[model samples]
Target: MKKDLWIGGEYRSAASYNELKNPYNLELLAKIGSASQEDVRLAISAAHQAKTMMVEMPAFERAEILEKVARFLRDDLDECARLIAMEAAKPLKAARAEVNRTIMTYTFAAHEARRIHGETVPMDAAPGGQGSLAFTVREPLGVIAAITPFNFPMNLVAHKVGPAIAAGNSVVLKPASQTPLSAYRIAEYFHTAGLPAGALNIVTGSGSKIGEVLKKDDRIKMITFTGSPEVGRYIREHSGLKRVTLELGSNSAVVVDEGVQLNKVIPRIVNGAFAYQGQVCISIQRIFVHESIIDEFTEQFVSETRKLKAGNPLEEDTDISAMITRGDVERTKQWVDEAINNGADLRLGGSAEEGIFQPTVLVNVPLNEKVSCEEVFAPVVHINSFRDFSEAIDLVNDSKYGLQAGIFTNDIHKALQAAKKLEVGGVMINEIPTFRVDQMPYGGVKMSGMGREGIKYAVEEMTELKLISFKTE
Candidate 1:
């Protein structure tokens, strides 16, 4: 299959191309465009033109287009899921789940487009504005540059592109180099669903080159990036004046209070820690268990982790897949080794095979260890015992990345208290830190990210608010 850059509503080959390898089996899937500076400029110009056309499109029409895209996605669901599984190294079940999530995001965005109503501000309530009538409406913010990550490539792309289109904004999407095919396929659906030319463009290339060009472009009004915190900071520093929504890295923690039922919570914690090989931003990197139940929790958690099937992602029965690459596996192993050297105990699954690192569990981890403090985006969980809820909360909040945190407590008051005190963006009670609904406001409080990505919230972020006033006698 031929893969090329999608520009101005058509597929255009780049001056140079790069090979896309399947992270799972190391097979060359296809070669995609290594978009150049000129290509980036063209994509930006196309997006600007598309944005103007999109803004003129009636809200209802945009909603119709999105609804059609959702339907088309359902029609091609199997193909989409297979492609995602092929490139992203996600297990078959997880890849299927991501496809379903992609559909939901588009469906929700379609419905939200019609509900994008502006409110009338009561000018009469103001001290000197009794005679004035004022209200605000949401307007498209021209061109949006959506830079999605490799993990959950299809769904995260939908999270950004769906809302951008639904809000009548044109998008220039730069899918992760490792997994660009799935996103490009989705962009094709936009065209087949009769979305206007230039409304959605895909540029596949080196992030450093294409990303810098897009971020530096003045016409690209907003950037929605999902990647590492290091890259996110660079984007913020270099990109001037334009709006940016960054969903960055996280070292998310889940606190299990003594008030919780151990039997039910331990399994959930295991799933949260080991799922997707723990590549998710909200995956439980650190677990702060109340000292009373620490031993019990650790025992059960290790048992459950052992039961997970680790192998090829394409295999239907495999519970865990390879890390995105061999480098990822090595990095995870290094983190485990460093933690062990720094007084942390490797409780279970610390071995590596080829490109697969075993799902690892570390106990009695030092507070200052990299595994405890850094964003270890791998299938490794660091365990620490806390004597009190306050101490657990403090430990959880100590990280700079406050994306999401979980508390397993039966006490409603304690749940509410943790919800209030936790510095993360979302809090789940009786659940692990990995819980997320597509409709919820999903962004971090601190270094995790800047803006929300749910359908309603993302539409708000993708558009600009404009107030109209009139002088009356």
Candidate 2:
């Protein structure tokens, strides 16, 4: 299939093109344009034109346009889901679910756009204003550069594009080169939905070239990126005087308190650790179990991990799929071997065959091991014993990545205490760290990221507040 860059509502060929391979079978899926610096500049210029048109669009009309786009997504759900599964190596069922969630995100943003209103402040209480009125309204932040990751390509793109368009801001999207097809489809839907030309642009290529251009461009007003922490830091360093919202990597933790039921908790933990081959930033990397239940939890967790079917993502029965690439698999194997060398006990599924690594669980993991400290974006889980809830909380908070952590506890006081003490963006009770809704404020606190990505919250981030003052004598 031929895939080209989308700029100003038209498909444009690039100076160079790259092949995208399916991770499951290592087959060439399609050839997509590798954007050049000139292409990036053209995209930014298109976004600037879109921004000018967006500000003039009536808020209700923008909401109507997004609503139409959501309808188009729902109509083409099956095709979109299949494209996501084929391109991103996501399981068929998970890909379908992701499409559903993406539709919901757009619909929610459409509804939110209608409700974006200003609040009036009574100025009579002010020191110098007796009969004056003050109010604050939100305006678009002009052009937004949306850089998305390969994992959850459809949903993450929706998280950025839905809000930017709903808030009346133009966006230049740089989808991961590995999975750019799904994003291109979304851009097509926007075009069909009557979005003005240049309202949304998609440029696919080497991240380094396009990312640097987007970061340094003065015309781009905001940068919304979802990727690794290393790249996020680079964007912050180079982006001058522009708003930035980064959703970076995480080494999220899950704590099992003594009062929790193991059978109920084990399945959730296993799913969180193994889903999408554990590529999710909020996927559970470390498990701090109460010493009383560590032995039993480890046994059950290993037994469950052994049951997962690691095979082709297109297969209906495959519970776990291949990693993003063979290199990722090799790196994960090395990390597992290094942890074992450091005295960590490999309890279950520590072998790698071809591109698919076995879902692994490591017990007696030392505190300083790479698997425990680093963001292992693979199908691996590290378990460490904690003497008490306080120690467990401390271990969970030890990482600079404060994305999301969970406490499996029935004790009300312990749950509340964890809510206060866990230095993370989200705290889940009686569950693993993988719980997320499309409406919640979903982002990290520290190195994990800056700012949030839910529909309402992202609209807030994509807009700027302007104060309007009125006086009557």
Candidate 3:
């Protein structure tokens, strides 16, 4: 399949195109048109051109358009799943799950569109006020630039595009190079679902080239990006007063407390730490288990990790597959070697088998190791023993990235304390840090980036508050 840029509701071919292949087997899946800088500028112009129509669009109209998109996605779940698996090398099961989440995200956007309103305030409460009424209304930002990551091609784009449409803003989306097909496919759905011609433009090509134009373009009212911290910082620095929302990197941590049901948590932690080849932003990287049960937990965790099927993502039972790139596999191997060199124990598979990076677990890794401190973005995790719950909190907080953290325990007091002191964006008391639904407000703190990304919260970011008052003198 040849997937080109979607500009102004039309599919246009670019001067050049990039080969998108199956990450697991290197089979050519599609050719994505490479948008030149001029093409990106044109996409921006198109979105800006359509902003007026979007502004005049009624709430019900916008809600119905999103509802149509949800229906389209729901009807074509298997096709979307196959595309995602073929492009991202995600396990087939995981791809189906992402498709379902995408449908939910758009559905949530439909509901939020109807709820995009403001509250009334009684101006008579002031001392000098009389016969006056006041209220605030949300106005859409003109156009939004959505730069998404490869880890979540469909649903993450839905997180941006769904809410932007619901809030009555046009969007120029530049998805990641490796997974551009999902965005292109969704653009087709949106155009068919009766969205305005220029309401959403899908620009394919180099993110840097497009971002260079997007950052300086005054027509772009806001930029919503999800990727590494470095790029997120670059956007924040260069965006120059345009509203910006970033969902950046995370080296998420998980705590296993003593007396926690080892059987219950063993499987959950295994999946959280290594699912989808650990490409998720909130994949568990640092684990601090209570010293009392650390030995047994590690034993059971390794047992479960070894049980995961590793091979082609097209296989239904596959749990671990090739990462987005071969370079990441080498980098993961290097980090594993570094940890082993620094006195860490390699508990399970760390080598590449059949072009797939095996799920690796480590023990006694130093806190300063790259796999421990930095976002590995690979299927590797390290387990360290903590003396107490308080110490576990400190260990989890000892990082630059504060996206999310989790603890497995039944103690309510300990859970509350962890919740208060974890220093991450969300604290999961009994669930893994990867626990996120479509409607929950999701984001990070510190270097992990800022802004929230649920349907309602994103609508808030994509709109501006305007106050109206009636005064009688």
Candidate 4:
């Protein structure tokens, strides 16, 4: 299959192409166009050109367009799942879930488009203002540069593109080089749904070459990115005052308190820690457990880890698959080795056979180890025992990245306390940090990047608030 650059609502041929292969078996999947400097500039220009049409578009029309796209996604859910599984190496079941979530994301964007409204303000509260009426309205920020990652390609793209359209903004999208197929398919959906020409342009290939143009382009009004912390910082520092919504890295933690239900909790943690090979930004990497229940928790967790099927992502029974790249697999192994050398106990699988790294577990991990401190974006988890409840909270907050954290406890006060003090954007009570719905306000603090990325919140970020005052006094 050949995927050309999506420019101005048409597929254009590129000077060069890059091969996309399956992460598991290296099977040739598709040949993606390698976007050049000219292509990136063209994409930017196209989006800038379409800003007027997008701005003039009515909210109901935008809502209807998104609804149509959602229907298209639902109709092709199985095919989209297969595409995601083949390109991104996600398991079949998980890929289907992502497609379903993407459908909801577009559906939510449609709902939000109709609800976009301004609030009335009272300007007569001051001493000199007696009869002045004021109100504030949200307006689109023009062209948006949306750079997505490989992990959750379709759903994440929908998170950006759907809301950008809802807010009446044009978009120049750069899907992760590893998985551009999903982006191409999505662009086709929008084109079929009757989006204006140049409203959304997708340019594939090298990130550095394209990113240099995206960050420095004045025509691009905003840049919404989800990737590594380093890249997010680079875009922020270089983009000047362009609005940026960056959802970056995290080594998310989960607190397992005493008196927790083991049978129900262990499977959730295992799924959270190992799903999609833990490529998710909020995957549970660090686990702080109460000392009293630590033994039973560890036993069941290890037992469950052993049962997960590791094979091809196309197989419906497979629970784990290969990492996005060999570099990522090697880096994960190195981090695990460093943790073991620093005195962390390797309680379960620690080696990689073939391309898939077995779902691994560690105990007694030092807080300063690489696996503990850094965003291990892998299928690895480190467990620590804490005697005191406050101590567990402290351990969860010790990281520099504060995306999200989870706590499993029956006590209402403890759950609320964890929610308040976890220092993360969201605290999931009796659930894993990986739990996220399509319509919630989601982002992180500290090194986890800035801005929120749910549909309604993102619509707010993609637009500027303008206040109009009527001086009737």
TM-score of 1: 0.98
CA lDDT of each prediction against the hidden true structure: 0.88, 0.90, 0.93, 0.94
Task: List the lowest-lDDT window of 10 residues for candidate 1.
Answer: 464-473
Give per-residue CA lDDT, model 2, range 105-173, as digits (tens). Answer: 999989988988779888888688887888999999999999999999989999999999999999999
What's the TM-score of every candidate structure?
Answer: 0.98, 0.98, 0.99, 0.99
Model 2 residue 157 lDDT score: 96
Candidate 1 off by > 4 Å? none
- Residue 345 local lDDT, model 1: 89
Tell me which residue pairs clash in candidate 3: none
Predicted candidate 1 versus true structure: per-residue lDDT over 246-317, tens digit per residue: 999999899888867787888888889888889998999999988998898899888888899988888888
Which has the higher lDDT value, candidate number 2 or candidate number 3?
3
Off by over 4 Å in 4: none
For candidate 4, list the clashing residue pairs, or say none.
none
Cα deviation in Å at residue 450, candidate 4?
0.7
State the lDDT of candidate 4 residue by residue for 1-473, as single tens digits. Answer: 89899999999999999999999999999899999999999998999899999999999999999999999999999999999999999999999999999999999999999999899986767786778888999999999999999999999999999999999999999999988999999999999999998999999989999999998889988999999999999998999989998999999999999998999999999999999999999999999999999989999999999999999999999999999998888998999999899899999878897789989999999999989999989999998999999999999999899999999999999998888888999989988999999999999999998999999999999999999989886
